[model samples]
Target chain A: EAGVAQSPRYKIIEKRQSVAFWCNPISGHATLYWYQQILGQGPKLLIQFQNNGVVDDSQLPKDRFSAERLKGVDSTLKIQPAKLEDSAVYLCASSLASSGRGLMSEQFFGPGTRLTVL
Target chain B: AQSVTQPDIHITVSEGASLELRCNYSYGATPYLFWYVQSPGQGLQLLLKYFSGDTLVQGIKGFEAEFKRSQSSFNLRKPSVHWSDAAEYFCAISSASKIIFGSGTRLSIRP
Candidate 1:
């Protein structure tokens, strides 16, 4: 099976600028996620979508960050007024089920978009 | 709330030697645990996961993790180290839906 696909493998933008990342999950996947990973740190969940419905976005910086999964297939994440702290790799992953124990269902990740805020 | 902890930030071992990486988690209910390996300039790949039954689970790349509920630990082990094994390993814990990961442990293989 094909893995998740992401575009713009790398992006460099000035602080306070806007940046957008796109992701296409595996076919027939019902769950999608956007995570931010800084150097030497674990990936942090920013938003989660379950079939076009948001399951969680508590950690998302609503003031500057937003994400949407339309029709439950493709998703886009936007970061407005990017800050130095936002300079990290944005990874997109998709899974078959919401239950973590969905062992048969692994979250396939994309190459990720490395954003540098200078 | 569930959280994962990797005590070792970095570890170095010679090639052909045994390896072990520590991971501890805290969750109120039965936790779903996972191990993922991330290479530089690459995405995180699932190595293995444990949900129920067998405490010792085998994953890809000759890696295995044993879940110890009494100690709240799920440590990864590899019998023989390979140069390609050098990468960052993360331990994740989840309950219900949302999952949380640890800071990650960097493994270095020396020739």
Candidate 2:
């Protein structure tokens, strides 16, 4: 089976401009996630979705960031009026649903989109 | 609040030397722990995870980690380092339905 897929492996935009990233999760996967990874730092979870509904998005910047998953398969993350601090890699991941850690469903990650804001 | 900590920012080891990277976590209940590796400009790859039972767990690429509940630590280790093992490693913890990640540690291989 194919891994999680993402579009536009790299992107560059000026401050105040807008940018968007897309993700296609693995088939039959029920959970999808978006994360931001700054240079020299671990990836930070931005939002998580389970079957087209949001499970968590506490870390998302409400004013500048927005995300959506339709049909429970594909997702898109957007940044409006972007700032220089938004320069980071946008990673997408997916995992199968399981009852507990005993089954332990690990997440599969995409190559990620590297965004640079000037 | 749950959190993960990785004190080492960078580490260098000879290709044939042993390697260890430290990780600590703070959570109320037992947490699901994980280690992931990322190559330059690439996405993260799961090395291993620990949920319950067995303090020591083996992962892909000959990597292993020991989970110590008493010390609230999970450390990744490799018997012998390889040049291809050079990458950024991250430790993460999941508790109360929330996942927290450490800052990460960069590993460099010496010829």
Which structure among the candidates has the greatest lDDT? 1
lDDT of 1 by residue, A20-101 (tens): 9999999999999999999889999899898999988999999999999878999999999999999999999999877644
Residue B97 error, candidate 2, Å: 2.7
Residue ranges of candidate 1 with Cα displaced over 4 Å:
A100-104
lDDT of 2 by residue, B3-44 (tens): 999999999999999999999999888889999999987889
* Per-residue lDDT of model 2, residues A1-118, tens digit only: 9999999999999999999999999999998889999887788889988889988889999899999998999999999999999999999998886334322678889999999999
Give the alpha-carbon lDDT of every model. 0.92, 0.90
Worst 10 residues of 2 chain B by lDDT: B92-101
Q: Chain B vs. true chain B: TM-score for each candidate?
A: 0.97, 0.97
Off by over 4 Å in 2: A98-103
